[model samples]
Target: MDSAAAVSFDANGTIGAYQIGVLISCVLLGVTTTQTYIYYSRFPEDPAILKALVAFVWVCEVAHAICVAHALYQFTILDYGHAERLFSRLPISLDTAVFFNALIEQSVLGFFSFRIYTLSMKLYVPILIVFLSSVRFLASMVTFIITLRLPSLQSYNAHWSWLSIAQWSTSVVNDVVTTAALVILLYNRRTGVRRKTIALVDKIIVWTIETGMLTSATAIFMIIFYLTMKERMIWLGAFTVSSRMYSNSLLASLNSREALRSMNATQVSLHSFVSRPGIEILQTTTTNTVVDITAKFPSQPQPFQANRQCEEC
Candidate 1:
């Protein structure tokens, strides 16, 4: 076969799609690893289970990157220009690599599940989130099984696109539910809080929405392209990097807590009273502003530690 004919069975766009996504994912993976290190370095007080979960996330990401790299190696380098092998049989490595997508996503969702539980203290919301997450994971698992069963990539798409649809749609719904829960909870708590406390909570709410959107939007794009660009694998390509977005969002949330807390501390300190003796001390200015953090996070208030911390800040 000539050069053009060699790559014809699968278009160049389809061939390049996974490679491009893997490259993007690898870059974001590096960012996530760095952010995880930063979170550990900054917050040694974080729970042991939380630390273990972070390590698990790292391992899943590394394994995912390796799997995709190997699949690409099989497609492009190891079997270069072998159209029959490339086009006729689906690589099992791709099956494993895409399965990692479900793993990575569920890990992030698990973390958020606990967070939603903590923030909302409602069992039903977390239960629903967990159920949706499980649906996504199971859909991906079924998709992988279908990939393994089918020899042809074309045939697999024809047979199993429904599972991909189910997975991506579940992810989008889960993210939307989680984001709405967080934002609503935060906004509700801000009602009776002080100015500084309200500002801090507002910042939290913004980050909450932003991080939620990152994953939600990525999954939405994946599903849209999956439906529209059937031959190109554009959606699958986006799936590679989208997991990193979730990890980065979680790490950012963890790291930002400390940074924002410290910064808020400084801002609070600036309000301290100046010790200057004056001839006429009839009027004095006191910059120390007291806050009731119980009123800040009304449901799960850390009155002694958090309220006093802000007061001392």
Candidate 2:
């Protein structure tokens, strides 16, 4: 191999190492977050759905860890010729794992949005969002498989340009749609002059939207980095590792005890105020009673009469 090829190969190794570290971190964060959410949060009011989503994320993270580990092992433990043969034959493995990881992330986000929607009583929209997300996830997987199976796969320069464009375009479209839906939910909650239930739902929707936006932003950055720095191993590694870390960290924060406590406190307060009947009436009556009692004091005329009698005596 020439100097450029040697450099490219070395860069791929660095990217693989960086990916391993990122995957490990993601697994840890996912585990921690899942535990915290399950133990500290309100259990999603539908434990089964929550459990399923958490399980999905955990499984995906495990797959990602496995793939990364395999890549690392291949690069470190095997000779170049052997590693090349193995990867060339099983290139789909790592790619498929990553596609699944992305699917898991998207599924978790969709479920979270659904949870917010359910709580707010906006039931119909979540179905559409989930469907759209699922379609996008499937598209990503298909593209990944196609890329893996393409002939001349060993030529890094084989210009899988169409696949790359499709992957990014689909991803961007998905994010835009998801983000827009979240924004609409938030706006409806804020502007709908209906009962306080809408307001409560709004708060939940806002939280859900913020979390989604964070994840989406990280994904966008990762896609951009991957496209622009495909040939630069250091840049690719840095972007991939940092983006993965941000995503995992955000997930961890969402499932943290602090997040649960805050959410619980807000829910409790809202429920208490909404469930209590005659509270406003009672407060009004108490104020009125105090005023009436104060106003019932004897007039100064009695005091004047008593003083006049004392002076005469």
What stretches of model 2 exceed 4 Å from their correct place?
A: 1-17, 20-46, 79-92, 116-128, 151-159, 190-210, 233-313
Error of 2 at 17 (Å): 7.1
Question: What does each candidate score in C-alpha RMSD?
Answer: 8.9, 15.6
Q: Which runs of model 1 end up more than 4 angstroms from their true locations? A: 2-12, 83-85, 265-313
Candidate 1 local lDDT, 18-77, one digit each (tens): 789889989998998899889778667555666777888888888888887787788788
Per-model TM against the reference: 0.82, 0.59
**TM-score (C-alpha) between model 1 and the true structure:** 0.82
lDDT of 2 by residue, 1-76 (tens): 4565454465344545456555555566555556645543543432353445555665665666566556555545
